[model samples]
Target: MGKKDLLSTEPYKGVRDFYPEDQAFLNYLIATFRGALERWGYVEYNASILEPSEIYKAKGSENEEVVREQTYTFVDRGEREVTLRPEMTPTVARMVAGRRRELGFPLRWYSIPNCFRYERPQRGRLREFWQLNVDIFGSSSLAADAEIIAVSHAIMMALGAKQSDFIIKLGSRMYLDTLMQNLNFDEVQGKKLLILLDRSSKMPAGDFERELGEMGVSLEMLSPKTPPQDVLDVMERLKMMGIENAVFDLGVVRGFDYYTGVVFEIFDTDPKNSRSIFGGGRYDNLLALFDDEKVPAVGAAAGDETLRNFLETRNLMPTYLPPTKVYVALTSESLVKEANKVAETLRQGGVAVSVDFGEKKLSDQIKTATKHKIPYLLVVGENELSSGTFVVRDLVSGEEKSLSRDGLLSFFLNL
Candidate 1:
């Protein structure tokens, strides 16, 4: 094909192509969150991106705007409607309901899955992104709610975030429902009002007030009311667990229709990234869509895009370090065999090694190592091979240390 006919190098709009460095940062984020979740006894689970389109269309799972507009949905070759999962909660609910007869309850499950949405790409909101979802099933107690919230706090801290760096604003759907009932809102009107409140932060105050006026409600009527005891108890428990930043805010109505009880959002304290990092809440009725049986569940998901933005805003993003620990630079083409032996020895000792194979000048080989950010450089030349000793150069510090083969293996292994 001619140049004009060549495909553009750019990724599709609203999605990302993760280059090595980008993937390394994503790995770091997933690793940190995975460690925290596993420590809390949460096991990982995953499912395909394609799920039945009707799952999102279900009344209790997602709202109509998301189902009708945002989802990447189409009829598959099998003549069945399929969707690239826009979120994970419905999929997990389906899985749990499908196996409810065989599974043990109070399940602590987690998943890091990439979700898709057909929306305008913006900071923190992408058309394709990965999310760390942590959920607990078969528990209706407030402790389950508290524990799920605590897991969010723990994951944030694991990423080197301080309590002052973010705040958990708690709310309850039950409390919002009560206020709506007092305002005499019927079910349809109540749904509209909740969605309006969920978008309140993004809309202008005048617009919000005018919309509430249209709904025959006033700003005063929506002002902060006392949260239900379930919300208060979760907040108290989080405080007792040393998560002091969690506070009750009456405005936190999570966008999903599934949330039946206490809901929350973790917001970055820094004004530069001023938005909810992630949020979830108790949804006891979602499983009912599959059958009459209801399974109580509480969970939260942290999006990789939003989490990275939060870390970058606060300068807490971890540095990307290549997995290769040392690069073997050969002095001459004749030394390729010796270089391989040295590389193999290091590999046997659990040290990541890369051999230059005398393809470049020794100095250029060292430059290649530096370019790749490999921490150590080992020059395999005639003298080093004859003496059975290698000089390992620290790429960062410019320090040199001579060691025998065994000593070199021990050094890299210890490092």
Candidate 2:
């Protein structure tokens, strides 16, 4: 028999397979990340996965280029053209525009979304992946930018990340345009240069030179790489309002037309990974493209799949998988509801409790407890019920403690 062709029948590439182990860990990771975001006062929101193709086309955003270049777009049976969202900003913008009048100033919205793009899948890249999108609408000040970056830092720190793990390489749309316009470059030429500049770090110096030369750029212009001193001095004053670590990089054009100013890229500071982790910037022109009032916005979308790999590279996630703090067990089936009642009571005390509903041997119950890493198991049965007392077993320490019905609540609360 001849070798079969892949397209004839095969699983789609660039998707994921979440086995049980992956499911458990992913749940824990999402919980930890969301907990951090919520602490920053960012409310969760979601948008439709399918959006009109023109939504991206209007501002000529990077995603629009990707839509023409890499999106998995198709026409519906009704001939309605739709595309899977490659990013979330435009969808968010559409939602904002619909209710812009009612929405108060400085809206903070976040979403963990599954976005798609059709392209060559590689390590740290996938066609389908989840991202953490942090957006601040109606704020144009540098304080908002600082808060965004700081929250990103906080999330990383909460997830056991360190400063040295990544570097925030900042740039400004105003700075870039001011320099390019100073060189007498028109908007058309400036955009071409930006497309080239976006690859500055990726391509070798000679390749970068040739690529620019092919576009009528010169070696001398590329040599004095960053913006001139006076312009940078002004931006430095502007950047001071942000966190001290934010830097001005001439090479960071952000590859998105919607970014009007204060652009930045986040790169891995560790030598092992030098790629950009994520990028975002202020976009003041996007809403204007919709004929809606210009609403200044800034946000970032971090690829969770990419970040998972980065964290895994650094062994950054917590171990032991957030062990169950409480497990309520019915030593006899007769005490099912009682065990559940005690479990609920303990849970209300801010403890994580699991109830055993299976009719199994007590040994089987203990085995289940040890297997699931439930450190504390609460036992309720006839003798304990009649006496208004309870038995608790600490699986790891092999210690059993008994407490009165009144004391059970305090016992678990203290643990």
Candidate 3:
């Protein structure tokens, strides 16, 4: 055969290759948020990443950019259009609609799943990342909205974030519609204005005003008004619930087409990560795409990339801890079987143990244990086998102690 070509080792652009240390940090994030959600009676659910393209293409699912430009769409051998899901809201809505009759009302569900989007890779944007999606369905109560916001706040707090570290910006589609009607904008203008306003924060003030001027609407007309009663009630509920950081900002219009009522976004207060972390809003009519029935829902999603950035900027990243608590090093090749037996014994006693079968030097074995961040190291050899005792060394503190095999097992089990 001729010379073979080697494939590149790099992963696809904008995606990540999570080594052990990286994975540990991700696990910490998921575990922390999941614990908070479960405490609030939010059960977990998941779905396949592949979804029918039509779901996102529907007018009520996602924004136009996602469906037309950002989704990873393809055709299978059978010629059916498929898309890797860019978000979880549409998928969850479909599931609820599919089992509308069998399921109980007022469901609170959350999921952390990997999502794909064909977008430019930047500080807070990626082609692929995992997200935590929390939603409440079947309830039109503004209490459900408050609960959703409360759950989100709890997640940040659980991750050791203070209320001053972030602020919740709330808004409503009902308020926007009233403003539009008073501006005498037709249907086309209203749609255009919403799109422009969605992007207004990214544009300079002069440019935003110039664009409004071109549309024959002055910036003064867009001034904030008294929020709709629904928005006010939700804000009051949030305040009563002790979520004191929430504030009304008409500019919090999320970039989703399906949001029908209240909307909100969370902003990191740190200057280094001063940007919208994540947000969701009420999408009462999303189920209409499936049938005439209406299901009111409000939810939000936290992306891992932005969440990690937030934690790192604030020095709140969790320390890495290896799952294996002890490393059993072999002093000689002759002790191979005994080493495994000791490892199994500790494992049966509920201690995570790793056996060093290579029979390297004692110093090298200790180095290996330290490299893997294993806390305790035990040496198994002929003396230990004869005396029925093992000496366990603390890799972290450099403290060593001699104990009977039974004592070693009990010590780790209790720890």
Question: Residue by residue across 1-415, what tens digits does model 2's lDDT show?
Answer: 5566434443489877775556676776678768988998989999889988888777665556778888878899889888999888888888888889898989999998889989789877889888788889998776676667677766666777676777777666776687677778887888888977887877888998888788666767554566545335434654564434455566787877888777767777766666567678788777775655789998877787667777887888556543468777777777788778777777787778888884998788888888887788777778877898777888989999888877877777676
Superpose all Cα atoms of candidate 1 onto the true structure and report the RMSD in Å to 1 decimal. Answer: 2.0
> In terms of lDDT, which candidate is stronger, 2 or 3?
3
- What C-alpha lDDT does candidate 1 achieve relative to the native structure? 0.89
- For model 3, name the residue pairs that clash: none
User: Can you tell me which runs of candidate 3 are displaced by over 4 Å?
Assistant: 1-4, 60-65
In angstroms, how far off is 192's CA in candidate 3?
3.3
Local distance difference test, per candidate?
0.89, 0.76, 0.88
What's the lDDT for candidate 2? 0.76
lDDT for model 3: 0.88
Clashing pairs in 2: none
Residues forming the 10-long window of minimal summed lDDT in candidate 3: 59-68
Please report the candidate that would top lDDT against the real structure. Answer: 1
